[model samples]
Target: MTKVKVENLTKIFGKKQQQQVALQMVKEKKSKTDIVKETGATVGVYDVNFDVKEGEIFVIMGLSGSGKSTLIRLINRIIEPTSGDIYIDGQDIAKLDKEELREVRRHKMSMVFQNFGLFPHRTILENTEYGLEIRGVEKEERQQRAEKALENSGLLTFKDQYPDQLSGGMQQRVGLARALANDPEILLMDEAFSALDPLIRREMQDELIELQDKVKKTIIFITHDLNEALRIGDRIALMKDGQIMQIGTGEEILTNPANDYVREFVEDVDRSKVLTAQNIMVPAITTNLDIDGPNVALQRMRSEEVSMLVAVNKKRELLGTITADAAAEARKNKQTLHDVLDKNIITVEKDMLISDIFPLIYDSPTPLAVVDNEDNDRLLGVVIRGSVIEALAETTDENEVMDNE
Candidate 1:
């Protein structure tokens, strides 16, 4: 189910008199520069539309002035849109009254900002319970909730300490704990980790991933870093010039860019780190254990023009692998294929990164088998050396073209 849906959401900034003119100029396909020159109005966001699913980390990413921040603000109605609709849980928030909007912010969604936003005077526990206090929750109940959130965030030990005493990452965790204390259904994080040092930023990213596995809250994360987005987002929306260039999973954005702009944005990314065995593997050729003999295996390899063939039982469970040379020798000896099976076949899970498989591929003579983690290690496909090279080479060529352009 869609938790949030935005339709034709547009935000224009300037004098009220010029807002309509700026919107008209946008409708006429005028450039932002021309629109600003003619109407003295800036378009913060333009005709944006997308949905956040029930429990997904939907990242909105772009460079400075991309209006990603504005889009987030619009979702919670922190900034009113000049024109459009913002729907949450099938209700149009744009049409909500002041009291209803307040309830939505108080109970349904919580935001985390880049600044950490922890109060200097308040203890970590006090800061975390602030939201519940504002809602007039009982002191004991709120305290319990806040402590639980702090524990989940690994900040319970420092609950009595002030924000000044903690590191930047810990302060951010306090802000996250505060958000979670309300048990909000959706999380709006705007550059929440961008202010931290690189090492700390990575730690926080891992923490969020681990937290999400347990909490499964619907998260709308905003960031300027492509690598961070690729690491954390289930799906990402690439924005530019107050518009979205593309929206897709990390692998899709890297492997199949929507246009020149997106291609350029991801051209510099490390493909070996993002591309996985599932992305490069081709279907494996195989012979059956129930009926196929050594001659059948050799014949299959020759017809497929491959050096090796995988062996599977009646249930498609991977038994092992057999090479044409081994199969031919076994046929001459009149032995069953299982007698000469190469049980020690190299295999990698579907999600294993190409970088992690480089050494394994180098040491193995035959293509590495890609197997499903469940289903009794069923053979899914084969990852040949050429396939890995080709995947990397294609991205390199694309990047070089982008550099040339």
Candidate 2:
């Protein structure tokens, strides 16, 4: 389900005739600077469209003056769109009157800001309860909810501490806890972590990712940092001037840019930091140890044109690997594959970064097994050296060997 949908949304800042002229220019697909110079009007956002799915972290990223901030504000009607539709749960938010819109703002969504917008005079628990209080939740119930939210954020012990006493990161946690206390369906974050020190910002990002796994809220996060966007966003929209340049998964946008502007925009990004094992892993060729004899394993190897085959049981668990030499030896000696299987295989999680994988793949003699640790160590795929290098060099080939390229 789509939690939010923005269609042809536009926001222009200027007088009446000038705005009309600018909207026409926008429809004519005029450049933002040209429109501003011609009509004496500024186009803050122009015909932007995207959807945020349920339980997604959808990021809008760009440089300083891109319409990312304006676009986010337009979603909740903080900034009225000149012409377009904003849909949340199939209702057109742009057409709602003040009371209807106010109700939606109170119950359906919450926004977290960059400056850690906590009340200086209130204690952390009181800050967390602020939204619920405004909604007229009874004191006892609101207190319980607020405490629970704080506990979820690992800040319950600091409930009595005032905002000034907490560190910047802790204060930001209170801000997040406060938004979550409302139990809203959508979260709108605009550069929420940009103020913190680098290390603390990273910690906050990790915490947010972990928190989203538990709460499953639909989040639209805005930021100027590409690395931050790639790390957290399920999908990203890259913007420039007043329009979106491209919208895709980080890997998609990095490896296959939509246009020249997008290609130039992402040229400087470190691909190793964004590419993961899943981006480069190819399907594993395997042999079943419980059923397959040595000849079966050798036949599979020969068919796949590989020196080895990963060995597993029916459950697809990562058992071991069987080399061509071992399989041939087993066939000549009349032995089973289980008797000659090598269990010392290197394994990595599917999400492990290519930067971290380089050394592991560089030193290992064989390919790395991409396994799901939480899922009974199930074999997901195999990550070969060529695939990793190709991925970092801005290519996405899911085949295992360099010779395949």
Candidate 3:
């Protein structure tokens, strides 16, 4: 379902005369006035539209002053829009009165800024609990929730320390915990990790992904960094001069550039990191033998020393996987491995995260498995982690050429 919708949104700054001053310069071929007017009546955002899916991390990216930040601010009503409708969960919030808007901000959404925004006088626990406290949550309930948020954000150990006592990365986690403690459905982030060191930023990005895996809240993240957008966003919305130039998945934007602007943005992307198991898995194989007995399956397991065995129907298409225990159970029951084998499987479809393989890397004696798309369950290929890492290394080398060029 669409969690948020922005339609024909535009935000223009300055007064009427400032706009005219700029327009008049164009007619007279006046360089000085043209520059003045363009700067004076700048359009922060113009006629933009898009929808954010529930539980999606939708990113808005552009160069500074490209209206990326302004667009984000408008969605949250941090700044009133020049004109357009902003909808959250099918309700048009643009026309909401102050009290209604405040309610929305308090209950439905929470934000994290570029700076940590921690309170100097409060300890980390107090800082994290501030939002819940403001919403009039019971002190005990809010404190317990804050502790969980802090633990998830990796700030539990520092809960008793002041913000100044922790590193920048730790403080940002506090900021995240504070935002998360409200149990919001949508998270609005404005360059939330940009102020950190590169290594710290990378760590925070990974942490954000982990959090998303667990919670799946809809997120609207604003940034000027293309790499950051690709790493964290489920879908990216690239903006230029107050307009969205393109919106698509990271791989889509990388493999099929929408225009020169987007092409330039992704010119140096390392493709392998963006690729998933579906891109390289082998075709599924089928075999028909009445070895459904547990003794036969145990023999196969001992012979192969495999962690799991794939079970298929007559066509060799995937049905599910069975582990060693099932084979033993089948033997005890005087049944074939086929009889006791499980057909339900937790397989990755193409476009699944490369990181998804982390669990599977050490999961079986065989390094390869049938790949499927998580969205459609369509088979893709068989993949091994070694090949993925090699592909990433090759992509890194390829990216270096563009950097030097």
Candidate 4:
């Protein structure tokens, strides 16, 4: 189910007259610079539309001045929109009164900012329960909830410590726990890890991933880093000049970029780390174990023009593999295909990253078999060296062209 839906959302900054003129200019398809020059107004977000599904991480990403921060602020009505609708689970929050909005922010959504916004004067536990405290939750119940959130954030032992007494990463964990203490249905994180050192940032990212697995809250994460978006987002919206350029899964955006701008953003990304066996694998060439004998196996191999053929049972469960040479030898010796089957073939799970399959591909004489891990090791497809090379090379060439232009 869609947890949030934004349609034709816009936010303009300037005088009322200039904002109205800028909004008109946006509808007329005028460039942002031209609109600003003509009307003396800045478009924070213009006609941006997207949806966030329940319990999924929806990342909004762009370079500085791209209005990513503004777009996120509009979602929670922390910054009111100039036009359009912001729906949270079918309610148009854009029209909500002050009290209604406050209740929404209190119970349905919570925000975590870039600057670890923890109270310096308060203990970590107290800081965590601050939201609940303001909402008039009973002291004992709020404390219990705060302690649970802190434990979940891996900051339980540090609950007694103040913000200044902890590392930057620990302080950020407190901010996360604070957000969790309210048990909001949605999390709005605006560059929550951007302030940390690289190592600490990665650790926080990992922790968030683990935390999400446990809590399953719908997260709307804002970031300027494409890699971070690709790593954490279930889907990503790439923005520029207050408009959404494209929205898709990481693999979709990488392999089939919407435009040259997106191509440029992904040019330097390591495709091996992003691409997986399932992304490039072709259908497995196989022969049935019960029905097909050595002669039939050889014929199948000849027809497919492959050196080896995978053998499967009636249910398509992988039994073994047979080489052309083995099949021919078995046929000559009047033996069944199973008698010459080789069970030592290299295999990779369908979800295994291409980088992880390099060693297996290098050592295997034939293409690496891709199997469904959730299934009974059923053969899904095969990933040849050529296929892997071609997938990576194609993106590189496209990216280089984009960069040159």
Alpha-carbon RMSD of each model: 2.4, 4.6, 7.3, 2.5
Residue 9's lDDT within candidate 3 is 87
Better of 3 and 4 by TM-score: 4
- Write one digit per residue (lDDT tens) for candidate 2, span 1-405: 998999999999999899999989988988888998999999999889999899999999999889899999999999999999999999999999999999999999999999987889999999999999999999999999999999989999999999999999989999999999999999999999999999999999999999999999999999999889999999999999889999999989988999998887776677788878988899999998989999999888889899999998989999999999999999999999988999999999988999899999997888999999999999999999998877665533222233365
Model 4, 93: alpha-carbon shift in Å? 1.3
Worst 10 residues of 3 by lDDT: 282-291
Better of 2 and 4 by lDDT: 2
237-309 per-residue lDDT for model 3 (tens digits): 9988777889998888877889998988887766766767765565443223343555555566677766556
* Candidates in descending TM-score order: 1, 4, 2, 3
Q: What is the lDDT of residue 229 in candidate 1?
A: 99
Off by over 4 Å in 2: 288-291, 300-305, 312-318, 372-380, 389-405
Question: lDDT of model 4 at residue 212?
Answer: 100
Estimate the overall C-alpha local distance difference test score of candidate 4.
0.91
Give the TM-score of each candidate.
0.92, 0.90, 0.75, 0.91
lDDT tens digits by residue: candidate 4, 209-317: 9999999999999999988898888899999889998999888998899999888787788787788899989888998988999888888888888889888888788
CA-lDDT, candidates in order: 0.92, 0.92, 0.79, 0.91
Tell me the RMSD of model 3 versus the true structure: 7.3
Q: Number of clashing residue pairs in every model?
A: 0, 0, 19, 0
Model 3, stretches more than 4 Å misplaced? 16-39, 280-349, 352-368, 373-378, 383-404
What TM-score does candidate 4 get on C-alpha atoms?
0.91
